[model samples]
Target: MAVARHVADTVLFEGYVLYPYRASATKNRLRWQFGVLVPPSWTAVAEEHDFQRTELLMEPRRGATLALETRFLHAGRRTVQRALPDGGFETVPELRLDDRVLVPWDEGHEEQVRLTVAVDELAGPGVVVPFTRPAAETTEPVTDKAGRVVGRLVRRREEISGVLRIVTGELDGPYTTRRLSVVVENTSDWTPAEDAGRDAALSRSLVAAHTLLCLDAGRFLSLTDPPEWAGGEVARCRNLHTWPVPAGEPGTEDLVLSSPIILEDHPSIAPESPGALYDATEIDEILALRTAALTDEEKREARGTDDRAAAVIDLADSLPAEVLERLHGAVRGLREVTTSGTPRTPAPAAGMPDLGPAAPWAGAGGADGAPRPDTPWWDPGADASVDPAHDHVLVGGRPVRAGSRVVLRPRLRHTDAQDLFLDGRRALVEAVLHDVDGGVHIAVTVEDDPGADIRREQGRYLYFQPDEVDVADPGEAS
Candidate 1:
């Protein structure tokens, strides 16, 4: 559960702040872009959603029970008020006292609701858990070094309401599995005025909403890659706005995280990550280095923006040399080459000799220990046995080489959306290539395309694996 929490936290605060972390940044103006559940009244005007649905397959044993935890952020408006000379205070965007600065901003408050239910109880109407958080306001007097009231900070939160509904149904199949569905909806009754803007809606919305499920005696199946027997059942599960994936440590199926962001099974944080920068998609090393280079004024503004932003500035300033080095990069899963000059995996084809214990550019001799400088490893001309112009690959037990015709069948998972348009299109094989990873690729040009010759002359062609293409009619081969 701890490991899963780390990933969930990352998803929760993703895009909470962008690079620079300053409130003045244009990109930071529009926040809370992920997993937002606005009120039902605003749905019609804004085309935004008020609910999120998550469905998953679970196999439970006798007396199996499930625990669910719903987490989100409650937004609040923070305004800075300046002390008047007489007695009244006026609203101000920024207030400063000594070295500290305060700015008006929308802050997020973390909220969580948890409940445990027995598997047997979810058979009929299931269960409904209604939760609400009341609105509140607080004020903090900001005083200068002279102990005189200089200004004050006012924070106000709007009432938030939501509901979590869970239901289960027995799957009709040979396997004893059941489909569990959970829906999180914002039931706040507040309706905005005619001219109410996004700020008004955000105050009552559930920001960054997500759910975590833990089973006491059951295992959750993987929707991305399910067993052959349960493939049909898994396909029928309808997940909307959110995706359910296996969580916790690798190989642990007792916990599940349904998040608005799509993630692979068993997602974990990188060890080199120092802390949350809010923008999870950016490289940490780059963000840290860039953050460390901010100007003094920029850093000050960032710190005064929000507490989280201040923490980020402090982290960048205090990172140790050793920790910064670790953030540079780390590689994993590469097999170690044996000292006897043989790789654990199979050697390359007969013509391409292994480079032995030393790298080809190490100034050492070839695998046979004979000096050869004219043909460097990087130059393709160094290998006389390999020629892409005449190379051939087997497809459907038929040889497919240069000038051969084929029909494209790009895979949905591996190919982009635009590549789907090329499906069933006839193409002329231009060449066969092999990557350093030993994967084969077939380059082709659309046969009916008017610019086929121009593209071929420019040395540009669409590439695909053998399985993604089928041999055309023998008569069509040139």
Candidate 2:
């Protein structure tokens, strides 16, 4: 099983409870989450915008001494470097508590938590409410009139939203609870200078760019089920969140942008990478790559070795020059690390596989006129096959005949190794028949057009289209 990462550090933040209530004891395995907002320092890309809306899930602690830790992430900064010049903070139950929230003084700090503390002490009254909500939001950092970095925006909300059940306890009378308006406020701070022109302009652009990017990306991804998520607007006015500029104090100004920002963590949208254009096709394995992780473009200019040159030349024709150039380079780079018998490495451990592996064989029999021997299925050499007719595998309301050709459309997948790529790539397949052999739909054999052999090629692999693919007999009506 993949290990869950537990991040810890020091950091400043702003956020609060959406709604709070006394969680009933009957709430089995009650989940506690603490989400907060932090400031953004640099862009996710140069000339490209990136916003920070950091959130953390807080678990119930045993004592009064509550320590909050957060995952401190910076686009390109090293953990050690950021810790030196500017220390970091992990989110916990420490920030605010009706002004009476206190912690042990470690040397010159009022932050660190001591050994053991009481639950009531750390979670006094409604204090634990804001500290435990799944949230992640960001505010534009304040810049000086000259466009240099200046101040930052802060937010503190004490609202709650949850359900209540008597569970065995009785209320004095009909109890009432409140829910915060879905409308969230977009806020940041700015030092109003005598010449606030640059400051004002920057602020406007920041908000406009953020709103435009979020809404535009959200809509675009919705078209094909994008892997990344941020925020969005809802149908009702409740989605209209009320926000204020930190220094502006409840008053709004230029570049005002508001919408529900849905924050999430995605492996597909690695903070250091870009989006992909094509789906699973071997024609150009460039979509899921992390360019920033590369040293430079010069290193990208790779040459095929004698062993690989043949494979390159073999696959060039259908590959298109640009595609071959990239795939060949990628394969060569991984030759040393990837073993011949072993499958590809660094595959998206989370996303559905472009091609699934065969299932273990249930039979204990073997060929060559030998006696059947009982053996474990895990043995790689074991063969597994299933009879579709008996299994009720449907095809035209009946079992499909063997060795029949049925045109079908594949789900969107980019077979290319690199993920962050531009569109118009294709995946290849060998002409075959229908059968569930080796516990897989062996009828379809996905192939890769190496692009290595083609001279001055200008072709692309297949891309997915929902309304396009159909599975019918070769002689059937169109």
Candidate 3:
């Protein structure tokens, strides 16, 4: 559960704030963009949704109990006020007290609701858990060194209500698998006016909502790569907005995390990460280095923006040399390289040549088993065989080179969301390139694109692997 929670926290605060972490930044103006569950009224007038559903397949043993934890962020408005001589406070965007400065910002308050139910009980009507948090406001006085109250910070939280419903149904097959469905809906009664902006709707919404499920007995199956027997059942499982993935240890399946972000099974945080920078996609090493290079005024503004931003600034300023070095990079594993730029394996009888121990630059060392000082690995001129313009790859038993026409067929597991749009689209192959790791990639431009010629002229084309595309009209190309 602890390991799963660690990964969930990353999802919870993703994009909480972008780099620079200042309120003045243009990108930071409109926030709370991920996993937001707004009121139903706003959904009628806007594109945002009001609910998220996650369905997974589980095989439970006798007397197995399931525990569910729904977690989210409740948006709060923080207003900075300055005390007037008449014993009243006036709302201000920024307030300064001695060395500290305060700024008005929208903050997130963590909210969690938990429930446990036996697997047998889930056979009937299942379970319903309704939770609510009432509206509240608090003020903290900001004083100087003399302890004189100069201003105040008022934080207000809007009332929020939501429901978590769980149900189970036996899957039809030889297996005893059960389909578990969990729905997290925003039941907040507040209805915004037609012209009300996003800020008003977000106040009563569930930001970054996610669910964590654990079973005392039995385990959950992987929806991404389920067993052959459960493939049909897994396909039948309907998941909306969120994706369910196995959590906890690498091989363990007792815990599952249903996150709004897509993730592979058993996703773990990198140990080299110092902490959350709110921008999960960016490299921490680069962000840390960039943050540490901010000017004094920029750092001050970032610190005054939000508490989390302040913590990030402090973390960047205090990271040790050793920790920063670790953040540079990490190598998971290494593979042996043959004379040809491919993974080493037993030489075949016909095609491959037996270079023996005298192969040049073989195994990261020269023929004498010593580091080759004359030839460096990163030198591109050292390898003369890789010519993108002349290189070609075989697809559908046909040689595909530049000007070859191919149809995109992106693999489901290895593609991004944007690549789905390119599926089945006809493209003209521009080049067949190879990476430093000996992987072949086919670069192409969409045939119907208006700027295809411009992109080709600029040497900017979409790249796909050899298997991700199919040769079109082999006879015509030949």
lDDT, model 3, position 463: 92
| Model 3 per-residue lDDT at 217 | 96
Off by over 4 Å in 2: 1-64, 69-119, 123-394, 405-478
lDDT at 459, model 1: 81
Candidate 3 lDDT, 1-478, residue by residue in tens? 7779999999999988899898889888889888999988888878998889999899999999999998999999999999999989999888875444688889999999999989998886888889899999999988878988888889999999999989999977788889999999999998777678999999999999999999999999999979999888889889998999999877788999999999988898988899889988899999999999998888888887888998999999999999999999996423334325554444332223343465444455543343432333334344576667888999878899988999888864457887778988889999888777678889999988999999999989999988899888755432
1-478, model 1: which lDDT tens digit per residue? 5658999999889898888998889998899988999999999889789999999899998999999998999999989999999977999878865554678889998999898999989998999999999999999888888999988889999999999999999987677799999999999998799989998999999999999999999799999978888888888999888999999876778999999999988888888889999978889989899999998888888887888998998999999999999998996323223323334344442324455666554664656655544445334454565567898999999999999999888854456886768988899999887654567889999988999999999989999899999899867643
Q: Worst ten-residue run, lDDT, model 2?
A: 10-19
Position 467, candidate 2: lDDT: 23
Clashes of each: 0, 69, 0
- Which prediction has more favorable TM-score, 2 or 3? 3
Q: Residues 1-478, candidate 2, lDDT per residue (tens digit)?
A: 0111100110111110000101111221121111112112222112322232211111222321222211211111001001122433333322222212111110101121112223234222312211122223343333435664333333222211211110011113232111112111122232334554321222212221111111111111111122232122111113221121111111211111111223222211222211121121222334223212222221121111111212222332234445434554431111101112322233232322222232222233222222232333233222233232222223446343333334444433444544323232222222112222322231321123345225113323233222223345455542
Scored by Cα lDDT, where does model 1 land?
Answer: 0.85
TM-score of 3: 0.73
